[model samples]
Target chain A: MDEIIRINHITKEFRVPDRHEGLRGSIRDLFSRSYHTVHAVDDISISIAQGEIVGYLGPNGAGKSTTIKMMAGVLEPTSGEILVNGCVPYKNRTRNAQNIGVVFGQRSQLWWALPLVESFRLLKDIYQITDAQYDEMLALYRSLVDIEPLLHKPVRQMSLGQRTLSDILAAFLHDPKIVFLDEPTIGLDVSMKAKIRTLIHELNRRKNTTVILTTHDMGDVDALCRRIVIIDKGKMLYDNDIEHLKKFFGAYRTLKLRVKGDLSEQAKRIAAELPECSVSANENWISVLVNEDKQKVISVLSQLQKSYDIRDMQLEEISSEDVIKRIYEGGVV
Target chain B: MKRKGFRFYLRIYFKILAQDLKSKMSYRADFIISTVGMIFTNIAGFVSFWIMFRNFPSISGYSYHEMLFLYGFSLLSVTPTQCMLDNNWNLRQQVYSGDFIKYCFRPINLFFYYESEIFDAKGLGQLAFGIGTLVYAWAKLGLAVTPLAVLKLLVFLAGASFVMAALQTAAAASCFWIENSFYVLDLAFRFRDYAKYPITIFSPVFRFIFTYIIPIAFIAYYPGMMVLRPSEVSLLSWLSPLIGAVFFYLAYRFWMYGASKFNSTGS
Candidate 1:
């Protein structure tokens, strides 16, 4: 893989003015203003290679946007260095913008009143895209995304899912070398999520477009990302392949057991017997966290079966929320 | 992406402007009502002057018709700023709503794209009224109407309008820091209407501040002086083109500086 992006010790500090409340405070601020530094992106460094689809994951306000802004040339880092395709993004904005595309799920770049394809044509002009290239990209986008009915509809009238698909099309129509998708599938249904995931994968595979995706949706990470960078509190927690991460914190399973009667006694018994397992009782279900020790699950279930008539037993994979907590707790590196 | 020429970006701006006009047309009744309302607003300014003239011929040395020329000339001078650049008047709303993010992400120039976002055909009424007033005032003044003088007036109005537009843009850019600067803009415009009258009518202190400190006078007063009182127009009036160009650059630079520090309050 060819290195296309190199960020070294980049930190973005915002001097947020700490203004007091009320008219008196505002007057005071005029005379003696005060500000506090918010380290939105603490000193963090990561190099990305061409054609690599990396998931940039973090909780809200964990600095995902700050980093994206820096990379996209929308912002400048307070300290440190960043180079995209051999040029500093903020220093050479137009040059860097030429090779990079960005899709912001919260804000639409599509003209609100224009038909979706008109926005695409407007972008075609902006990018100086040739007719052949435009047709080629349109064909590829059409095959991947089912936005045919939406192409003629105004952006303001389109559903979130349709708009998202259209936004994705506009972002990639220029055939940018790199694409940054910020929460690309947010506020979409399961089917929409799957469609977008397929589109993302197809874009990367067909065009070899490097992608940096920032999303709270784990299904996106699971569906498309081979590697992911996890950030917490303005610092990198883990930067590695998904396989390694899953193996390090080996895929834990959850057993959701519903009992015939009052199940707290048996749940307590299982807790006592399998001390390593995490056990919790909520409503009618007793969710038992079982990992590594296969026999522990069997021993616990047999004990539960003995105590009460086994009404139902469901085994599930560890959830995204739990995985994020584990990363925050430094359980994986 | 391929490297596009200047024409390419102009086409993009045209497309964006077309989209804006179409969007404005979406609410047909609102468009018509707003157009009528704008005409009435423009007419009201003249009406206030007309009512005042009914009581007294003029406030200072000038007469009622001369004041009309002054006021109409000022309106023509501000057409590009207040009318075409109307979006700058409400840019804080866009900043607060995070629509500024569109320009940030696009490959086109931010300033141009931002301006294009609001083509503002709603200004048509004002523009028509302004041109009509200027023609009426010019004919009423009954000057020699030399082509050279006409050319000079056009040039002055053009340069002054550019300055006005630049000032409006600078005000909008301040929102990057102040977050909500419509109040600040309102305050600026409260003093702005005074330019519609002769600056000489005010105290010397106000005259100096509006001329040198804020330079609001240059937008209409000084330029209008070129036609109204050419002898009083000093050698500095020659620098109108230079001042307009430089000031426009500085104002746009100020906008870019603010945008650089912009921590997008994305909702």
Candidate 2:
């Protein structure tokens, strides 16, 4: 595989006006205006190979979008360098744009009121794609998905899922070297999510197109990405394959319990008692990441049973979501 | 390997324009209402002119037909911008919402891409109304439609259209710097009203401002003067097309500067 993207210690800083609270403060602010810098992406370097589906994961406001924007040539990094397919993206944006496609999840790139195919045709002309290439892509789309039904449907009338699907297809139509999908599976149902994931995976396999996807859904990461990069607070936290990430929280099994008392209090108690395991509460379910090397699950359960009433419990392996949560919570990275 | 030059862009432009028209035509009622509404608005404006002319033979040195010619030229000049540059009006909203990234993602020029986003059909109504007024006024003034006159008119119209689009683009490009650029663009829109009247009626300072500062004079007033009173028109009137071309180039440069300063809204 070829290294198509090379990011070297890139940092993007935004200077926002320091707004005042009230009338007097605002008046004073106008007299002496102030600005503070926000480091959206700080000293992050990543080298991505061609034909790789890399899940770029982060919590909300976690610099994932800033990184993606830099890659897509939408924003220039305040410091350092970023090269995509041997071109500095922001400097040679038009040239970089020739080799990349971007889909910002919150907005549709499609013509809002036009039929879906019209947008595709417009893209065809913009990309200057040959007729044969356009028809072949259309045939590929039709074969992979039941796209014929939605081809003539106006984009505004289509459901969110349908619109997202169409948008993904549009991004790939030009056969760009890379595609940046920001939250591609956001606000989607399970079935729709599955379909999109499958479509992305199939496209990657068929075309060997590099995919950089920013998503919150761990399910999407599990289904599509072979490797994942996690960032938090403008800093890189983790970057490795899924299995390695899971193994980072070695021999950990999730001990889920439906307790009688307040979930938070119970969680705290369990945390105090176990000492080695990480415990978190959500509604009535209290989940504990119990390390088998440190303590046996049976013993931990028996100890919990002695103090509190455990109505129901289940033992399972640590999931990717838990690993992400642990990293997000600044627990075991 | 990349297609370059005017022909490629022209082909793509027509395709985008077709898509825009197709999308707009879907709402048949809205299309009819807006187009008809525009024509009616122009008619009401014409009625106001008729009332003014009926009360007095001439407001300044110009006759009723000359006033109509000035008004007609203003309308013709503005029609191109109204038709093609409607997307610039919403650029602030698009930028704030981060939807403007769509322009950055395309391989084409950003300004060209923005222009291709939509085609305003309501502008056709204005175009029709403008042509009708100019023809009526021209016949009343007894101005013969010679090839030389038509060629000169074509140049003036093109020049005026470029100026109109340039001003709009320059105003809209401020969205990249400020949060809301509507006020700035509104000022530009208000200045268009000044072009419909004779600048000679106003004070020298204002005349200079309209001519040099904002260049609203070239949009219609100067061109109108060039056509109606070629002997009395100044040398500046002959340079309307040059001024327009230069102004448009400056506006385009400003747009590029603003875009470079663009730190897109956080996603």
Candidate 1, chain A: TM-score against the reference: 0.89
How well is each residue in B76-120 modelled by candidate 2, as lDDT tens digits? Answer: 999999998898888899778766767778887888887788889
lDDT of 2: 0.87
Candidate 1 positional error at A204, Å: 1.2
Best by TM-score: 2
Model 1 ranges off by over 4 Å: A18-34, A256-270, A280-286, A296-299, A305-315, B1-9, B264-267
- C-alpha lDDT of residue B88 in model 2: 89
iRMS, all models: 2.8, 1.8
Q: Over the stretch A81-106, how does candidate 1's per-residue lDDT look in tens digits? A: 99999899888787788899888886
lDDT of 2 at A59: 76
lDDT (Cα, tens digit) per residue for candidate 1, span B81-192: 7656676776787777766666787666777767776666756776787788778877887865899889989888887777777677777788988966987677666666
In terms of docking quality, model 1 is medium
Model 1, residue A12: C-alpha shift (Å): 2.4
True lDDT of residue B175, candidate 1 = 90
Which predicted model would earn the best lDDT? Answer: 2
